[model samples]
Target chain A: MEIIKSPDALKAALKATQGSVGFVPTMGALHIGHKTLIQAAREANDIVVVSIFVNPTQFLAGEDLESYPRRKEADEKICSLAGVDYLFYPDVSDMYGEDEVSLIAPDVRGYILEGTSRPGHFSGVLTVVNKLLNIVRPDRAYFGRKDAQQLMLIQTMVKNLFMDVEIVPCHTVRDSDGLALSSRNAYLSADERGEALKISRALTKASHLVGKGVLESDRLYAEMLAVLEPLEVEHVAIVNRAFTPLDTVEVGNTIILVEAVVGTTRLLDNVWI
Target chain B: MEIIKSPDALKAALKATQGSVGFVPTMGALHIGHKTLIQAAREANDIVVVSIFVNPTQFLAGEDLESYPRRKEADEKICSLAGVDYLFYPDVSDMYGEDEVSLIAPDVRGYILEGTSRPGHFSGVLTVVNKLLNIVRPDRAYFGRKDAQQLMLIQTMVKNLFMDVEIVPCHTVRDSDGLALSSRNAYLSADERGEALKISRALTKASHLVGKGVLESDRLYAEMLAVLEPLEVEHVAIVNRAFTPLDTVEVGNTIILVEAVVGTTRLLDNVWI
Candidate 1:
C-alpha cells in the first residue's frame, strides 16, 4: 500500500487508478467502524483510498480540539491490513491556511440536531469533506451511518453541490458491550465506558419497540429514554430517513437516534429500520 | 458545438473532451468582455466549455435578478463564432434548491469593498462558482478582472479547497469610451453609460501616477478620486496583489481599484500592476 500526504501525490495516485475508486475519510484513530467503511470500499471499487486528517477547523474552542486522539502508527497498520490501496495522511497545515474561504451549512437542516449541539461542527466537517472530495474525486465516498447527522449533511452537500460521487452509507460497528465504535471511546474511564453503552442500548431498545409493531415516535423515544436510565441524555430523536421529525414510523425508513453525555465525553448511536 | 443544460450532461461532455479544458462561466448576455474571456480560453486549451447561469442566490433581495439582461440567441451565436466546444445553459430552478449548501467568504476579506456594499454577495458567487467548476472539472477556469474582488476571492476559494483547476485571470474588456463591459451595462441609459467611463478613467489615472513613481497609497486614491469628478464614487483604494490594503504602493505588486455609482447601477473597474 502506498502512503501519501500531499494533495498532488493524492491526485497522482488517484489518476493512476484505472477503474472505480472508493474513498473513506477519517480522523486517523481508525476503529472497527472505519474498518467497516474501508472494507465496503474494498469490495465495491477497484481501488480504495483512505484519508487520515485531524482537521482543526471541525473542533470548537471549548471542545476536545487540543486533546483529540491520534494513533498514526496503528492507523497505518489498520489500513495496510484492511487492504487499502492508498493511505492519505495530511497535517492541518497541508489542509488549511489563514484568511481561507469556508463552507457554511444550510440555515435550517444544519442548525438542528447535532448541529445545534455542536455549533460550527458541521461547517468544519463539510469544509474539510469538500476539500477531500475535490482531491480524491472518488467514484463512491464511504461514510459511517453512526454519525447520522454528519452523514446526512455530507450527503445533502454532495447532492446540493451536484458532486458526481456516490455516497455509500455503512452500518455502525459496535464493541462487545454494544458501544458504538468511536476513537473518542478511548477517553472514557471504565465507569464512563460502561455508561456509554446506555447510548447504544437506548437505540437498540427503540429498535426493538419498532420491530414489535410500535409506530408512534413518542413511545419509542420514551422507552428509549427509560433505557438511557439516569444518564445526561442530550437528545432522543425519532426521525425519518431525511432527519425530519416523524410522528409515525414508516418501517423501512425510520431512524431512532440517541446522544448522551458521560462526564466530559459524549456518546452517540442510532438504529436504522 | 454541443449545448448541455443538466449537470450530468455537462460532466459527460467534460469527460469526453481531450487535453486541457478551459472554462468560462457567465450569465450569458454575451458582450465583448465575455468574448475576450472565451477567446483566451480558446487559445489556452484544446476544449472550451462556456456556462451561462444567472445564479439567483448571488443577487440580493432588492437586486435586479429578475431583470438581469439575457440574450440567449445572441449568446449562442457568439459561442459558435468563438469556437466554444460546449455551451452549458442551466436555469435558476435547475441550479438551486430550497435548502442549499453555500460557501461563505472569510470574515475579514468577505465583508469589505463590494462585499461590504452588498452583504452575502460573495458567498453566493463562491457557491455557484464552486458548483460550476466541480461540474466542469476543467483544467483551467477563466474570470473577468473587472470584478477584481470576486476574482481574488475565487482564487482564494480554489486554493483553499485544493482544487486541481488552474485559475486564469483574464483582463477586463472595455469599450472605446473606456467603460468596463458588463451585462449590467445594458441596464444603464446612454447618459449613465457615458458616466460609467469615469470608473475606468479613474483607474487609468491611478495607473499613470503609479507608473511615474507615486509611492503613497493615500495620494494615489485621493488623486484618482479627484479625476472621477461629480460622479458618486463608492470607493477608491490601493491594495497589494492579495487584496490586503497597502500603505505604500508596491509598484509591480499593487492593484488600484475603483467603484462608482452611475445613476442607479454600481460599476467597478480595476488595474492590476
Candidate 2:
C-alpha cells in the first residue's frame, strides 16, 4: 500500500487510477468494522483509498478530542493485510485552516438525538466529509450503518451538495457478544465493555418488538429504556430513515436508536426495522 | 442555447457537455458585466454555462430580493448572442429547501464593511455559489473583479474546499459613461444612473494615485471619498487584494472599493491595483 500524507500527492496518484474507485474514511485504530468497509471497497473498485483522520471538529468542547487513540503502525499493518491500495493519513493542518467556511447541518435533522446531545457535531462531520469527498472524488464511498444518523446526514449531504458518488451502506460490524465494533470501545473498562452490550441489545429488542408488531414508538422506546435501565441511558429515539422523529415505527422506513453511557464512555447502537 | 430549470436536468446537461466547461453564475438583467464573464468562459472552455439566480439567502429582510429584476427573455436573448451553451435559471425551490444547511462565513472576514452593512450576505452568496459549482462541475468558472470582496470570498471558498476547477477573474465591464455594468442599474432612475457614475470615477482616481506611488491607504481613501462626496456615499475603503484593511496600500496587491447610493439604488464598484 502506498501511504500518502499530502493532498497534492494523493490527488496526483488518483489521476492514474482507472475504473471505479471506492473510498473508506475512518479515524484509525483499525478494527473489524473498518475492515468491513475496506473489504467492500476492495471488491467493487479497481482502486481503494482509505483515509484516517481523527476529525477534531466533530467533538464538542470538553469531549474526547485530545485523547483519541492513534495506532499508525498497526493501522498500516492492517491496511496491508486487507489489500488496501492507498492509505491517506493527513494531519489537522493538512485538513483545515483558520477562519474557514463551515457547513451548518439542517435545523431539525441536525440538532436531535446525537446532535442534540453533542451540538454542532453534524456540521463538523458534514464539512469534513465534504472536504474528503472533494479530495477523494471516489465513484463510490462506503459508510457503516453503525452511525445511522451520521450515515443519513452524509447521504443527505451528498444528495444536497450534488456530489456524484454512491454511498454503500454496509451493515454495522459487531462482536460475538453483540457489541457494536468501535475504536472508542478501547476506552471502555472491562465492566463497561460488558455494559456497552446493552446498547446493541436494546436495539435488538426494539427490532424484535417491531417484528412482533409493536408499532407505537413509545412502547418500543419504553422497552429499550427498560433494557438500558441498568446502564446510564442518554436518549432513546425512534426516527424515520431521514432522521425525523415518528410517533410509530414504519418498517423499512424507521430506525430505533439508543445512546447510553457505560462508566465514562458513551456508546450508540441502532436497528432499522 | 438550452434553458434548464431543474437541478437534475442541468446536471445531466453538464455531464453531456464536451471538454472544459466555463460557468458564469448571475442574477438576471444580463448586463455587459455578465457578458464579460461569459465571453471569458467561451474563450477558455469548450462549453459555457450561465446561471441567473437572485439567491434569497444572500438578501437581508429589508433587502430587494423580492423586487430583484427578472429579465428572462432578454437574458436568454443575450446568452444566445453571447454563445452560451446552456442557461440555468433555478427557482428558489430548485436551489433551496426547508431546514437547509447553511454556509457561515468566517467571523473576522464576515463582519466587515459590506458584511457589516449587509449582514449574512456573503453567506448566501457562498451557499448558492457552492451549489451551482457542484451541479455545473465546470472546468473553469468566471467572476467579475467589480465585486472585489465577493471575488475574494469565492476564491477562498474554492481554495479552502480544495476544489480542482480554475477560477478565472475577469475585469469589470464598463459602460460608455464609465458606469460599471450591473443588473441593479435597471432599478436606477435616469438621474440616479448619472449620479452612480461617481463610484467608478472615484475608484479610477484611487487607481491613478497608486500608479503615481501614493501608497498611504488613509490618504488614498480620503481622495476617493472626496470624489464620491456630494453623492450619498456608503463606504470607501482601501485594502490588500485579500480584502484585509491596509493602513498603506501595497501597489501590487491592493484593492480600493466603493459602495454608494444614488436615490434608493445601491451600487458597488472596485479596482484591483
Candidate 3:
C-alpha cells in the first residue's frame, strides 16, 4: 500500500503496472460502506487503487467542507489491510487550480430528490469523479449504492462521455439497526444517533408495505411519512431504477428513498424492492 | 484507412493497435489545413485517428449547423492518403442522448472572443471534445492555431480536468494568397473569398510590426484595424499565450488575433509571436 500524493506520480505509477486496475474513490474516514467498495475492487482486478480526496469543490459554501471527517492514519491502515496497491491522497492544491473547468449535471435527473436539497452538489460530485476517473484510468471503478443518485449519475456520465471504464455498483452496506453508513454519521451526537435510526426504519416500513402488496406510490409515501413522524423530512420518494417517478411500485424496479434531519445531522437511507 | 461509423467499433479497433495514438478531430470538408494536421499526427504516433464530426451543440440556434460543409468520400480519401489508421464517423444519435452530462468551460476565459458572439459555444466544444478524446484515447491530439482561442481553451480543459492526452498545436495552414484555410471558406463567393484575405493580412501586419519592435498593444490593434477597413471586423485582440489582454506585447509570449465577417461568412486568423 504505497501512498501517492501527486496526480502525475499516480499516472506514472499506473503506467508501470501492466494489468487490469480497479479503483475505489473515497473521502477518508473510511466506514464499512467504503470497505465494501474497496473489497469489491480488490476481488475484481490485478491492481486496486483507492483515492482518499475530500474534494472541496463538491462542498457548497455553507456545507461542511471544513468539519468533514479526516482520519488519515486510520484510512491508510484500512487501505493497506484491504490490499490496495496504491493509495492516492492528494491535497486540494494538487487536484485543482484557479479558474478550472467544471461539469453540469443533467437538467431533469440531476435536479431531483437529493439534487433538490443540494442544488449544485451533483455537479461538484461529477467534476471530481471525472478528474479521479481520468487520473486512475481504471478498468473498473467500484461505488457503493449508499449514494444511489451519485452512483446513477456517475454511471450516466461514464456512458455519456464514452469513458472506457466499467462502473461496478456494490450493494449499500449498513449497520445492524439498518441505518446506512456514512462519513457524516460521525457528526451525530449520542441522542441524535438514535434519531437517525428513524430514517432506516421509514425505508424498512416502505419495503414491508410493498411486500404486503401495497404498490401505489402515494400510499407508500403516506405510510413512510407516518413512519418519519415529526422529523423534518426532506423527501420520501418512491422511484423506479431510472429515478423516474412511479405511479405504483414496479417490484424489482422500485427503490424507496428517505432523507431526514436528526438534530443537526442529515441522514439518508433507502431500500431497493 | 478503416472508416468506423460507430464509436464502439472505433474503440474496439483502437484496442487492437499496440502503440501511441495521435488524433485529429475535424468537421469534414478536409482541406489543406486538415491534411496538415493529419500529416503532423502521422509523423508523431504509431497510429493516427481522424474524426469528422460537425458537432451540432457548438453551433448556435441560427448558426449554420445544417449548412455546415461535409464531404464524406473526399474526406475518406484524404485520410487514406494521409496514412490515418482509423477514421471515426459517428452520427449525432450515436454521440449524444436526450439527457446527458456536459462540461462547462471556465467562466472568464470561455465567455470572451468567439464566445461573446456565440454564447455557450465552448461548453459544446469542450463536451464533444471530451467525449471524442475519451472514445479515441489518443496519446497526443492535434489542433490548428487558426482557432487560437479554441486551442487555448481545449488545452486549459485538458489540464484543468487532469486529462492524460498531450495537446499538440499545429501551425495554421494558409492559401498561396495568405488567406487562412478553413472548411467554412466553402460558403464564400469569389468576392467574399478575396475579402477574407484582409483577415490574414491584418494578422500579418501585426506580426510585422511586432517584428519591428513596436510592442504596444493599442498601436498594433489600431494598425490591424486600419488594414481591415470596410470589413465587418468583430474584434482585433492583442493578448499573451494564455489569452490575457496585454497593454504591450510580450514578444515571444504574444498572440495577435483577428475575427472579421467576409460578407455573410465569419473568418478568423491569428499570428503567434
Scored by DockQ, the top model is: 3
Task: Report model 3's TM-score to 2 decimal places.
Answer: 0.98
Give candidates' CA RMSD values in order: 1.5, 1.4, 1.2
Checking candidate 2 for backbone clashes, the offending pairs are: none
- Best-to-worst ranking by DockQ: 3, 1, 2
lDDT of 2 by residue, A1-273 (tens): 999998878988998777788999998999999999999999999999999999999999998998988999999999999998999999999989887888889888888888888999999998898888888999999999989988988888777777889999999889999999899899998988877888988888888888888999889878888888788887899988988889998888988888887887888888877
lDDT of 3 at B223: 93
Provide the clashing-pair count of each candidate structure. Answer: 0, 0, 0
lDDT of 1 by residue, A81-162 (tens): 9999999998788888888899988888888887788889889999999999989989999999989988999999998888
TM-scores of the candidates are 0.97, 0.97, 0.98
**Ranking of predictions according to lDDT:** 3, 1, 2
Candidate 3 per-residue lDDT over residues B1-273, each given as its tens digit = 788989989999999889999999998999999999999999999999999999999988988999998799988998999999899999999999977999998888898888788789999999999999999999999999999999999999999888989999999988899999999998999998888888888888888888899999889889988889989988888889988999999988988888888878988899989
Estimate, for each residue in B1-273, the C-alpha lDDT of model 2 and write its tens digit: 999999999988777767989999998888888888899999888999999888898999987988988888999999999999999988888888777777778777776868878889998888888889999998999989888788888888887778888888999889998998888888888888878888888988888887898888888888987888888777888888777889988878888888888887888998888
Model 2, B166: alpha-carbon shift in Å?
0.6
**Candidates 1 and 2: which is better by lDDT?**
1
DockQ, per model, reads 0.82, 0.76, 0.87
Instruction: Name the lDDT of candidate 1.
Output: 0.88
Model 1: share of real contacts kept: 0.86
Candidate 3 structure quality by residue, lDDT tens digits, A1-273:
899999999999999999999999999999989999998888889999999999887787888989999999999999999899999999999989877789989998999998898888999999999999999999999988778888889999999999989999889888898778999999998888887888888888888888899999998888888878888998888888889989999999977888788887777778888
Considering TM-score, where higher is better, how would the candidates rank from best to worst? 3, 2, 1
